[model samples]
Target: MKVLVIGATGYAGHRIATALRRRGHDVTGLTRDLAGAGARALAAAEIRPVAGELADPAGYREHLWDADVVVHTAMDYADPAGSDRALIAELVAAPRHLVYTTGISLHGRVDTPELDEESPSSPDNPLHFRYQLERELIASGLPHTIVRPAFLYGHDSRTSQLGRWFAAPRFVGDKDKRWSFVHVDDLAEAYVRIVERADAPLGDIFVIGEENPPPALEVFTAAFRAAGHAGEVTVHPISPEEWLEQAADQDERVNSAKARRELGWTPRHAGPIAGMATYYAAWQAANA
Candidate 1:
């Protein structure tokens, strides 16, 4: 299979691209800079790097049409809705399988014990646009699969924000608010399974995360300890609405049984707390 990974230089994108290449697929990585470090790194891994922009389909539409599969991991935080909307519009006409990346945050605050792909999305959440995007992509009648991963950690993941808090070791919202997590490498494997399974139904949605989720207090405490901090972690209280606005601070517990049953995907790594020490070291190396 020939695969083209957009935003291939990013944390999750890079890992997904490499995993596909390792599986003997012809993989091409689309990035903004073809001569920069990320593109060079992709080339080093034997994945072709092509210069492109998510906002401008003309830059990457040819590559998209050329691939047997197209995985979109690119995100424009400045204009996420606009960029993603543009990409989805272009993907509607492409004759290929699409593995679109959406975050578990789209589920909003997990008021129930747990939620899955069938759960209703909370439009109150700041990232409600993503839920709308997911709907748009599905209704487009494209051969696509949507993956909503929980907080991604491992291997220099800035998204996890563990490194930022390692210095002070604190929980900014409800300490007991639980959140789901997945190692980047494990998430990559989920994508590999999705791509390899040719029989997967269109508009399928998969929630990717480890089995059990821990509270904010537990996650940060483990991260601090892993980074060799012996001090007590500070707690800061905030309103529930404020928490929801932060997105990362709200409860994000989710069930991945559907992914396991349908895609045969199993996360090999224990949750973040179990492997924080090693993950901390990897983050340090990547940042250094």
Candidate 2:
């Protein structure tokens, strides 16, 4: 199948794009510019990266027009209200099966440890606007599915959430906070399966998360040691206000039971406990 990934250069998007290509799908990755580190990463991954901007549909309309599936994993998207509205309008008009990527952070400060796809929505999150965008896509009667993936890791240790462990004397987070850590490779495979399989029904929500939700301190402590850091990996208490401002505490433990049961997506890494070491090795090689 021909696939068009809008955020092909992004951390999540790049991984998913590489996964799709590995599956032998004709994939085209859309990037705003074909320069700098992102381009190098795409090349190293053997993904076909095209210079296309998500903000301007006209620039990427040709690629989108020809793709059988369009997966949007773009982050830090342009001006939320206006840009998203226009982008959604164009997407709905495309008449293609669209898979929109969202994050577990949308669950937002949930105190529960085993939240699922049916859990209550967050009152506020940085990606709260995507909820509205999701609604618009489904309401448009387009064949689309939403993927709310867990905290992403792997590929680049420094790019991972646990990255602070390497440089900082101590990391900050509530010890009580737990997150369903998802390896980027596993999450990417989930996307490929969702797009390739006909069983992934429209308007359905699937979580790309792990069954094992690890505490923040435990995960980072392993990461700290993996990074060859000294002293204890400090776990500081972050205020709700601080979390809201910086999106620091995205600690909502979630389960991908539906995905596992239906889509047969089994995440490889349960958490950062062991993967951190492997990722650190990769980070060292890349930085060296």
CA lDDT of each prediction against the hidden true structure: 0.83, 0.74
For each candidate, give its TM-score against the true structure: 0.94, 0.89
lDDT of 2 by residue, 1-288 (tens): 999887888778888899998889888888777886787777787777788766677777878779899898885434655655565677677778888877677666555667777765565665566666777777888788889887777766444565545556365555667777788889898998898887556778888777656677777778777877767556666555554324536566777789988888897765667667787776677668
For every candidate, C-alpha RMSD to the true structure in Å: 2.1, 2.5
Q: Which portions of model 2 miss their true places by more than 4 Å? A: 35-37, 40-46, 77-81, 167-169, 237-250
In model 2, the clashing pairs are none
Q: For candidate 2, which ten residues in a row score worst on lDDT? A: 239-248
Question: Please, what are the lDDT tens digits per residue for candidate 1 over residues 42-121?
Answer: 99999999988888877788898999999999888778899988887787776588899988888776566776888877
**Global CA lDDT of candidate 1, please?**
0.83
Q: Which candidate is the best by lDDT?
A: 1
Residue 244 in model 1: lDDT: 40
Find the candidate with the highest TM-score and give its number: 1
